[model samples]
Structures are given as structure tokens and as C-alpha cells.
Target: MMKIDIPTMRAQMAEGDKKRDTGLTEPTTITAIKELSYGPHGIENTFDIYYPVGTTTCLPTIVSIHGGGFFYGDKELYRFYTMYLASQGFTVVNFNYRLAPVHQYPAPLEDTNALMNWLLIHGKEHYVDTEQLFLVGDSAGGQLAEQYATLTSNPHYAGLMDFAIADVQFKAVGLNCGAYFIGQTGAINQDFPFYFGETLPEQTAQQFPVESFITTDFPPAFITTATHDFLKDVAEPLATILRSKGVEAEFHLYENPDGKELHHVFHLDQRNPIGKQCNEETLDFFRKFL
Candidate 1:
């Protein structure tokens, strides 16, 4: 197991994020419904949905998996970014999942599954076009999004997880600065224990590269990373791997026109022009399927 001060790290991350999101309000163009429960874990299992204001037609839905190292993050923190997605004429769902130290591997995954199911059951209430679903995740959330999308198409993996798959197909997924080969990727390697709770056998471990579980059935992907993203290396390789498996994958590396640096998950910043471009381009990718 990786050595980590779980409580302290959580506290520190929460503080840092609070400052990062200071004064940000939900977008005026989007209407948001907050904290609707979808699972047994109460708050941790709750989700929020965003919709373009006053739209009567069923819209393409985007389920957003937030990132904070898989241990910290909630729908509230991602509200602005997701609302932007809703503003683009998609219904967006962002949820809180049970975090590590208290919950393990399948917990967060299970919560995601539950949220997807809830959406299907409540489609009319949320103005979601269940058949036109898409997913987007960044950082650790990217890992969950990938894994969950895998579970949907890979029955064997879903069985191993002992969780039922979400009963919907994703038209495509946006993986933004995601960490894929979990156990082998540096800092992400250390968080493996935080994710799975215990070690597994060699064969099972081998499948965790996230590549082994992926098949041609996986959804097409739009993978992106900033010029200076810590996980920039993960993007292209994943795209190549997906294309090799006969899945459509698009890769983009956003370079700053200025000499300034663009760090991890920079696309989440609604105010960044480049970030807006990144978001719109991803939406464009999803539009191709629709």
C-alpha cells in the first residue's frame, strides 16, 4: 500500500480548491438542480444536473467525472465548468462519490454506476436524451470515466467489479489530462492503495494498465492535454492504443501562444480562451456522433 496521510491530504486539498474556486457562480445561461440523491451513501452519492435554461427538447447528456486525485472532488467544485457544457445545449450531470481511506475501489465506481442508472430512470425530469449520452473526466475522474466506460462495454470486467453496468452506451468520452496506467504511473502509482484498498494477483494486476480491459467495443474518445500537463504523456499513447483497438480516438495538445505555462486540467478554467476552445472542440467531437 502506498504511504499517505489521508486525512491531512484531504484537508489540504479542500483548502486549496476552496481558494481556487473563490467567487465563481453558476452560469446564468444554465439552470442547475443540485444535490439529488441517487445512491445509499447520502451526500457522497448525490449528483447535480445542469441544463440550458428553458429548453423543452431532450438534449444530449454529458456525465462529468470530476478530478482531485480520486480522493477529493465534488459536483459543487465542478459546477461552473459543467454548466458551460449545459450552456452548449447538453444536459450535464456531476456527482460526489465516496472517496478513499473510507471507501475503496468499487465504491466510487459503484456510485458512478448508480448515477448513470438514476439518469436513465429520471430522464424526463432532467431533459436528458438517454440515447445521446457522453462522458468527460479530468485527472483522477478521467481514470473513473475510462474504467466505468470500460465496464459498460466489457462484461467480464463488470463481473470482476461485481457491479452492474450502467444501462446506457456512451456516444463518446472526453479524457482530459487523465491518468490511465494507474499502478505504473508515478504519483498515481502511490495512490493505488488509496484506490483499490489492497494488492491483487499478477494476472489481475496486469489488466489494470486499463489497456488490457479495453476492447473494440470501447467508446470513441477525444483525448487532450496541455503543453505542460503533468500527464501529457498519457494522452497520445491512450489515443494510439484506442485506435489500434479499432476505436476512434482524437488527440490534442494545447500550446500556450504566450510564453506562459499551461498546467494540469487547465481546460477546466471557464475564463481561459484556450480552455473555451478546448471545451468547444470536445463538444464538436461529440457533435459528430449526433
Candidate 2:
């Protein structure tokens, strides 16, 4: 079993923050920006939008969700990535949903769905091509993205779907080191009680498992996992599930070229050769689909 050195990880995270502030490891630029709030859940339920300059015509949009174990991350932490995608000519929306231990299952998912509905309703006004919607998430965000896709497709969530402003179709989804399953086999399954307030019932837990929820109608997906990641098993099975359902799917496992690194190290060390290569491959994959 691979173990994460918490102290070393914290140091690396601090280093990344320093690099971000110094602009030495910034991603890219965005032309215009806006704040979006459509719910009554107070200021924390808001999102930021980034678009290219002079984009009057409808343009593709990518909604990015950040990850911090469902308890720590915020939209701002992912600004670099969103801005980079926006610079590539895709409108990018990054938002904060309610966190766990305060807001449990269905809350975060509902918040994301609300954001999606808001986007569809306001897409035309924002000059967005609602039909070309793409969902991208890293880690916890990826899990929510998959859940959102599943929820939107289910008739039980029809009321949620009815509020969508436009006839948006999810074209593709990108899962970066996502936690796709959340039961006994999950990496952080033990953390569920901490997040959910209590141990989840079997059925309740099943609802959050992307592998169990996926259907043939689920959109195409591109998923990535690091070889040394604790979550590697979490995402790989979902790729097989997607293919079995005839949904286009691609999965890549990245390993450290020097063979010395740990899970979730990619985002923290962007200058690392393997990390850079993974980002490049991700961009190339997006270009092919978008």
C-alpha cells in the first residue's frame, strides 16, 4: 500500500501556492470575467465565468469543478486551469458548491445542477453554445460531474431538468483523478461518515457511485489516473463500464518517468515532466472532442 506523507504533501501544496502568486506557474489568460449567482444559498453558492474577447457568437463552454476532498477546495484554486481553457477559446465557468460535513450528499450535486440549469437559461445572453457543453472536474469535482450527468438523465430529476434555460446536451466529460466509486472499495470510504454526518445506508451510498449510475446515455468521457494514485482503481473501472455501454471512453494511467512520486502529485507539481505531459495530453484530447 502506498502511503501519503502528509507533511511533505502540505509543503508541496504551499510551494504551489507560492508559484501561483509569483505567476511562475500560471496557466494562461482569460479576456472577460463575470460573477454568477442564481440561488438563495448565500454568497458561497456563486461561480465565476471567463470568456475570450470579442466572442459575440455562441462559443463552447467548459464548466470546471475543483477538488479538495469535498471539504477544502474552492473555485479560486482552479482559476489557472479555467483561464487556460478560456484562453483556448472556450468559455469556462468555475463555481463553489456547498461543502460536506456542512452540506451532505444531494446538496453539492443539486448546487452543480442548478449552476448547469442557470447556464442553459442564460447561455444565449452569455453568447454560449449550450449544445456544446462540456463537464470537467478533478478529484471530488469529477465525482460530482459524473453524478450531475447521471441525475440529469434520470426521470426522477425531471423537475431539476425542467429548469434548464436551454436545451443543453453534455457533449463530453473529463475526469482527472476522480473518485468514481464511494463504497467499501473507495479510497476514502471511511471519510464518508465524516462528510455525511453518519454512516450512509447501502442504497444511499450507491447513489454516489459513478460506476453504478452510468448508463448508455451517459456522455463520452476522458479519464486519467496516476499510477501511484490511491484513486487509480476508482476511475479505471468506470472506463470499462463506459465502453460496455457503448459510450466513447478513454482512460490513461500516468506514471512518474523517474519512478518517484505519489498520488495527487500532478496538480501540485505542474513543472514535473509527467505532470506537464498529462496536461498536454488532456488539452489534446479536449481539442479532438471540442
Candidate 3:
């Protein structure tokens, strides 16, 4: 496969995250099913499902998309955090999607579709109540989650995609430190090929934004960011747009703790008290529609 030529920034970022999660330990209260493949990409397409150890009945499910600026991250990186979510009473699916430069636009989206289908087939056997499904993503994963949710809800946008839409109803979505408005930023003009694998025509570009494709059918959302997150500016605008379209939108901007700015995806760090607080609030938001 001819991969796109990109910088080593992804590697550097991955190292940083590994360091961030180094000392954290997952709680023993949850049960985990690991390394199940949903697509043909071997380990890259594999997933892990987490739920409370003694769960007897199906529970509300949260399918989480991992962050890495579209080029990095995996189920293992989210292992502890997803376990924490499970401990709090939910079945959580965390998985790896094909990354960019190696696998371009729509690959992760398609993988997301495959994962959903996989759940539809295997979910009941594993305590996933697909009927009460929800989506969550951070950073680049946020973009993928938002886009996938839009496709599931909006027929007009779903028609433009290459694959059949995944048949799943999302109760809500959590967009954490994510970019929701694409192409509105000038970077899209040049970064298109790097991520999407082609230069889009002006009209197509205009039609491709996550915001533009969102409809009233879009799932209710919990959008969040910290004072220092680069994507902090995106959450409010996305909530505004969703509200304009009659979708329920709850946006939260976290203030710094002890006057220290919180970086992007700070909620992923289980050690951070503020991150835990944010997760609890996000869970409360998801529970509302349940």
C-alpha cells in the first residue's frame, strides 16, 4: 500500500500519551472481552468490550472512538478509562480504527460502521444493549464519532457516503475536546489529501463539514473542552449549531484547576479529579436521554 508521506508527529504524540497513562491502573470491578476483530485489518480492527463483572441484564452501551489526531491511539490506550466507565454501570466498547497516512479518510468511518454491525450481531451475547447505544470520542476520534453519528441520523448526508449506513439508533454522543466544524478552518484546504486522500472540489468541500450535514435527527450531544485545549473553541459553536437544528446540545467548558490549564483530552486521564468530574457530568448528560 502506498501510504501518504507525513511527519513523525504521530509517533511523538503517541509517546506523550503513553507517558500520561504510565502509572494508572484499571479497577478490578469490571469484566473485559478483548481483541475481537470487527474488520479485516488484523489487530488494527480489533476491539475490547468492558462491563461490570456481575452484570446480569443488558445495559446502556457506549462505543468510544479513541483520539490521536486520526493517526494514533487504540483500545489498549483506553483500557483503564473504559474500565472505569464500566465500573460506573455501562457496557463500553473501545476499539482501534485504521489510522491516517496508512489508511485515509472514510477508513475509520467504515471501521466504525463495521464495529457497529459487529455489535449488532454479537452485542446481545456480550451484554451490550444496542437499543440504548451511545457514542463518545475525543480529538480526532471526536470528528469520526460526530461524522458517524451524523450519518446515522441524517439521510441526506448518509446518501453521500460510499458505504451503507450502519443501522443503529444513538441516544446521544459525547464529543470531548474534539473538532466538530471541518473546512471552516483554512487548514482543510491543504490537509485534505493528507487525511481524505484527495483535494475536494469547492462545492464538495462546502458540503463536507460536520456542522453542515447535521440535522434535527442528529443525536443529543454532550460537548466539552478545557481552557487550554486547542479545540476548546469548537465545542460551543457545535452546541449552537446542533441547537439551531433542534438537536439537544449540552456544552461544557472546564475551567483550569489551581490556575493550571488542562490540555486536550484531559478527561482521559483517570488521575485527574477534574477529568473525573467532567466524565460524571457527561454520564449524567447521557443518562438524561436513557
TM-score of each: 0.93, 0.82, 0.94
lDDT of 2 by residue, 161-280 (tens): 324422456888888888776653653346555455455555455454446656788888888889778788878888888899888888988887677865663653444667666666
Task: TM-score for candidate 1, please give it.
Answer: 0.93
Q: For residues 1-290, write the lDDT of model 3, one tens digit per residue.
A: 22433467767777887888998777778888888889899999999989998999999999999988777778898888788888889999999989876887778999999999999998998899999999999999898889999999988888887789889989999999997677775545354465665565554454467778888999999999999999888889999999999999998998765888888999988888889999999899999988
lDDT of prediction 1: 0.85
lDDT of 3: 0.86
lDDT of 2: 0.70
Return the lDDT, model 1, position 58: 85
Top model by lDDT, which number? 3
**What tens-digit string does per-residue lDDT give for candidate 1 at 105-218?**
667788888888888898778798889999999998998899888988888877775567878899999999998877555433455676665655454464476777899999
* TM-score winner, 1 or 2: 1
Off by over 4 Å in 1: 184-190, 201-207
State the number of backbone clashes in model 3.
Answer: 0
Summing lDDT over every window of 10 consecutive residues in candidate 3, give the lowest-scoring window. Answer: 1-10
In candidate 2, residue 106 scores what lDDT?
A: 62
- Residue 239 in model 2: shift from native, Å? 0.7
